[model samples]
Target: MSLTSNKSSSVLSYLESVSTSDLISDPASIGLTIRELLRRFGGASETTSLTLQDLELAFGKSIALGFSLWQHMAALDRLSAIPDWLANNAPRVANLRNGSAICGLATTHLSSPVTIHGSPSPNGYVVSGTARWVSGFNFFDNLILGFETSDAYCFALIPFPQPIIPIGSSPDSIRCDFRLLDLTALQSTSTGELTLENFPVLNTQLLSRREKNARPAPRKSSLKIPELGVAKSVSKKINSALAAKQTHPLSTDFASALAQINSRITQLEAERCDDSLDLAGPCHLLIQDTLRLFALLSGSRSLAAGSEASRLTLEAMLFDVFLQSENSMRLKIEAAAR
Candidate 1:
């Protein structure tokens, strides 16, 4: 469903009032903002069920908040698919649905080749390995992680360690050592590396397990939505700046590039393209071009630490590494070479 103009305006105003620097220094603030947005707009269901256009509208205002919300929504969507898991964890589900408890995603391994293995134990399971990139560190209470065993791939919902023990001190017990990364952009995401050693997973928390070879393929549409959303936001900003300076020499070039990008977005949305790998390259290039033009158009002001252009530029660059797989990277590289 589309977000009404009044609702959009309210969201925009609230997002605008948030300090980017404050968010960077204290990433947990993003969770609070997300909770407020969920409450204002129809709670968890509304967030999970948001259309691409709705997401684009939100992303246009603030990428950090938008990405965080998307991640939370995605985790909820995955968890809710398992009937037994939902029935067993009703109270936790209630907290998650109402925004009282935030959930983080650690399922990148399902798509990529990262190895997080789970072994059966008497009471439940023991998971051990590294989750290369887990976002929403301080903000999330639970994490839904995907791991593989000898013959099965499993998903589990577990509580994130509170007052995590020092790395070397915890040998026998379940240990999750979180190392927050120094990110150039999306710092407010609180992305980090989690090294799990003998992590305990209770029976109640085990969501699902399927044959290793039967792991579901990633949905191309869901994979490309965020990129398209952010690209549209960049395109709109660049187009607006060009409109204001009709006499600028580069206006024609900028207009042409944005036209192609906008057309690509339209085609993908209308056709629901399945070639997300192919879509990635062009979308990334278009966003880079638009952000570059935006910076150029803004002149010296865009170089400031607090500039909108600067923030968007960095956020756009984050797509290069954020949620990227090897195949997507090759396509992006090939596209750049062209």
Candidate 2:
């Protein structure tokens, strides 16, 4: 279901009928939007390039719509693009056995089934292993998990609403419990690990390759970093507000440092182009340093456990800042070294 197709005109109208006010707090509404997005844009050419500008616009608009309805104005500016839609559709996908958003960069390992043997079934191949760190898995009615095969990263979708394949849970994987993280940041988004012993994946569930193009498909960083960038900008604004009345040398220094790093970040962002790993390398590094600085600045108040500043530190530390920066940094380093 190509979202950019004429069929999307009606879908878009249906989506428009959904009051923007209802989308913010309503996980269901968010889920619907995600489904629409996938239906519209999911299976682009594997080697197609992404429109960074479009991504940024989609992200900002989604955030604005969600925040306006929920009155979470603080977070409104943190959205870089359509990640909210991507994450939102997880639950819905758990209901729809046919569709899955397997198009992205972080999913390169999906050359084969998650397990070595790839579960066998009398009818077709049944993949009975869990794919770790599957974001938006909760909403997916079926899952198209990627695995490292002998040849390529093969991806397959497994039907859902089935019994769980029990296994011991690990830190890096998704747990079957569906327990939301008690994370102060991204509390609204549900993420966890899965433990699959033999989660059945039928042969018909495999993701088919589309037309090859000049560029590779978008990756997780493509989905996450822009959002993180928005989040970082928001955090800076919040910190400025918090430090407005209270004067401290550390606060001033942090502000100055943040400004300086952000300036570099801005330059790098401007220079970033499609698949140009060299230009993106410095941007990723800048994000890492900026995150560290933000973390340090946010934790500055936590110098003492009992101090009034401790709470401030918690409020200041935006998780998106560190997580995306680290991921981006690794990519940059890898690209540079390569």
Per-model TM against the reference: 0.85, 0.48
Off by over 4 Å in 2: 1-108, 111-123, 148-152, 159-187, 209-224, 235-255, 274-338
**Candidate 1 deviant stretches above 4 angstroms:** 1-10, 44-51, 87-90, 166-171, 215-224, 273-278
- lDDT by residue (1-338, candidate 1, tens digit) is 34565566666677678776665456878888777666655354534433444456556656776777777777767776667777777777767766788788886446556468888899888988888878888788888888888888888888875544645664676676888888867788888888887888887787878886774755434534565666677777777888898998878877887787778778756644565335555566666766776788789989999798888887766678774666668878886699
Q: Judged by lDDT against the true structure, how good is candidate 2?
A: 0.40
lDDT of 2 by residue, 62-100 (tens): 442221112111111112223543355445333221123
Scored by lDDT, the top model is: 1
Worst 10 residues of 2 by lDDT: 68-77
What TM-score does model 2 achieve against the real structure? 0.48
